[model samples]
Target: MLEVNHLRFSYGKNPVLRDIHFRAVSGEMVCILGPNGTGKSTLFKCMLGLLRGWDGKIALNGEDIRQMKPGERAKKMAYIPQAANPAFAYSVLDMVTMGTTAGLHGLRVPGKKERTIAEAALEKLGIGHLLERDYTSLSGGEQQLVLIARALAQGSNTLIMDEPTSSLDYGNQVRVELQLRKLTEEGYSIIQSMHNPEQAYLFADRVVGLRDGYVIADGSPKDILNEELIEKLYRISVRKVDAEDGKGRFFEVIY
Candidate 1:
């Protein structure tokens, strides 16, 4: 349900993203993969309309994102950053309820039904116990889960996460990955930027590979995660092995 065409962005006189084009459909989990400084995150910001002065068009369906109001855009898409640190010592429930502002307008309060939905979102992420905890006091993983709960509370049709699993340990990474997979199965379009190709191959329906501000490959993970492409894009050797399921495989970089 998201489309980007000839998208371009720059910092000062230096260009960072060039002619990037891709489409993500409903019920699809798409991963944008790239090494450091390749502009994967910049592409996302452009799509979210957080950056201007860029050329080309980004739209949800046929409507231009630039034309939509901030609240309107928030209702259509939710963004989860690589990290979120709350300024105040807000309660977890209070932080998540902030997402409802798009639907609730200027007010920041959540009614009984909205609170129920927020609590359910927390429970889904397995962080129900943190509801009453101070956000700044929680651990990194806990805070990440709370931010995800906020995104879920936003209840947008599309979820755009930047390194959603970046900071967590291996186990917590798996937990969040599973939840993202479940979200896609339930009909939410998920677009995530990741540095981990293995996770991208394992969880993404399609992979969009970026190199030096341009899209190099966009296809099924199996097709896009091969040794040649990985080596060329990231300058690292990757090995692909047959997965037990037969329908998919596992990937790892060879040091």
Candidate 2:
């Protein structure tokens, strides 16, 4: 389990996150929902140890992450950032193999075991055919999947993604969401920051709503993602409608 308590952060004197608290358990998907610049990314940076001077606690499986070394932390969690543009056109397999570096020693190169792990990750995400392709040549969604495969190869039980579907088309968005759900079912804890409340409603077991650096709400998506909260979060009118198939609900913004 991942637990965060009374988390607070600031840039110099400009406070960003305050009293943020949440927990994500294995086999569960949690979505952090809020408008842009509500410190969602900042909160993620704090959890990932990319930022310092944070006041509070972030722990994974009862161990304080702040007390762990960089390599030790990587063993506990993995982060998938927004799609990156690689300077060099590295092959998909090479990119995925990079995840194994944290587990390797000095002057030691990836051999059969690392290659196998990378191959397994790609196969798990149904992208094994792209193994020999250049990562830069793939579409946004494919690149995103490759990044996820890298994280999977990292062998952490917890995955943190920043706007995993932000740059994808409708079809790709749905595809990524479905894959995330599958990962959770396979017992990988996922924490992703997203701006879409409907995605939260459809895919998240828990939703954490952040507004102006504060946790405005935290609960199951069905209970916490109502029209009122939607309006409050985005400052825009929206309505919730039951899906035709009755599997779940979706939010429609009223412009």
Candidate 3:
């Protein structure tokens, strides 16, 4: 239930994003796929109301985001940025509990109810044991899961994740991707920026291919993740091999 229409943005005199359009429906995962420097993050920032100078309309369920207050927006969508090592050590429960305050207009404070919601959120992600652990001491995967738990606690069904698996190991990447899939199955709408075409192909129901800040292709992964598009997006010669496995056949890139 999110729509970004004809979005354009610039930094000083240099334009970074242009004519970007996309939408995410309930219970769907839409992947914005592009190489680095293709304005993927810029598009997300504009959609999230973080950078409001852009020249287009961002709407949530047909309501312009600009007219909605910060708390109102927080009630409808949750943004999960890339995880990094923390500078200051904070309790894991303390971190996730912050999400419960998203809808608090002012004087936001977590009480016993908020703490219980945060605990349930951690349990939803199957990381309940990490509630007392130091956030700075957890593994990269655990930290990422905690971040997702925090987003869950925000009580928003629509999630925007920027490069959700960028800094994780392969196993952790798989873990996060599977969690995202499960979220969609549970009727959460997700819009994620990803550079890995294979992951998008495997996980996303719809793929929006972006290059030079323009939408070059938008369709189902089976229709968009082809040899020509992959080669064009990466500027390299490649072939798509239909590989069959226990799960079924999928596109395998051959260079």
Candidate 4:
């Protein structure tokens, strides 16, 4: 459902992404794993058309993303950043309902339908109680769920998130991962940049390893993750163990 080819981007004289080529199929969960300053975030920005001045092609559903209009892109792609610091003190419901702005432009504001979608998204994320509370006053994990609800309310086919579980505790992280798996099962394409390799191994159907702005490995988590590759990419040795799921593919990072 999403294809990126020979993608290259830079800031001033320093290059960030170099000749990156990958694809994500419908109902697939792809995890982008990379170290700090490895251009994972930059690639996401380019995919969302948030950054320009790059060389190469990014296509969404067979159309060049650069040529698509913003609103049109919004309808196809939903983005949830690693961190969001909204300036205003909007309620959780208000923040999530903003996702419909691109599709609900004719009206002065979001209508009942839009509100329903936003509220449903929040409820699905298990943050419905926070709907009436101030978004800024919530904890980090709560804010993250609210942002994800906002993205879901956008009603897009592809969901792209950067470090969606960066600040959450173990319980919350598991909740988010299960929800992500559920989203994929329901036929949504997901592309996420993640720092945790264990989470990637458990949740992602495919893993793309990036290092120094280059594509290092692209394959199934079992095919791409190993002692050597883990050491090379993350400078750590991870031990894989038998999982309770009996899938013959479950692993854990034994630091």
- In candidate 3, what residue range of length 10 has the lowest lDDT sum? 246-255
* Model 3 ranges with Cα > 4 A deviation: 246-255
State residue 143's C-alpha deviation in candidate 4, in Å.
2.0
Q: Candidate 1, TM-score vs. the true structure?
A: 0.92
The local lDDT score (0 to 100) that residue 27 gets in candidate 2 is 99
Give the TM-score of each candidate. 0.92, 0.97, 0.94, 0.90
The best-first sequence of candidates by TM-score reads 2, 3, 1, 4
Question: Scored by CA lDDT, what does every candidate get?
Answer: 0.87, 0.92, 0.87, 0.88
Please provide, for model 4 over 70-154, each residue's C-alpha lDDT reduced to its tens digit, 9 standing for 90 to 100: 9999999999887688899999999999998879766578989999999999987778999999999988778888888898899
Clashing pairs in 3: none
- Model 1 clash number: 0
The digit string of per-residue lDDT tens for model 3 on 1-255 reads 898889899988888888889889999999988889999888877777888688988889999999988888888899998985656798999999989998565676899999999999999888999999999989888899999999999999999999989998889998988988998999999999888887887889999988887899999987778878887787866666665564422444464
Instruction: Please give, for residues 148-221, the per-residue lDDT of candidate 2 as tens digits.
Output: 99999999889999999998998998988899899999999999999888878889999999998888999999
Worst 10-residue stretch by lDDT in candidate 1?
100-109
Give me the candidate number with maximum lDDT.
Answer: 2
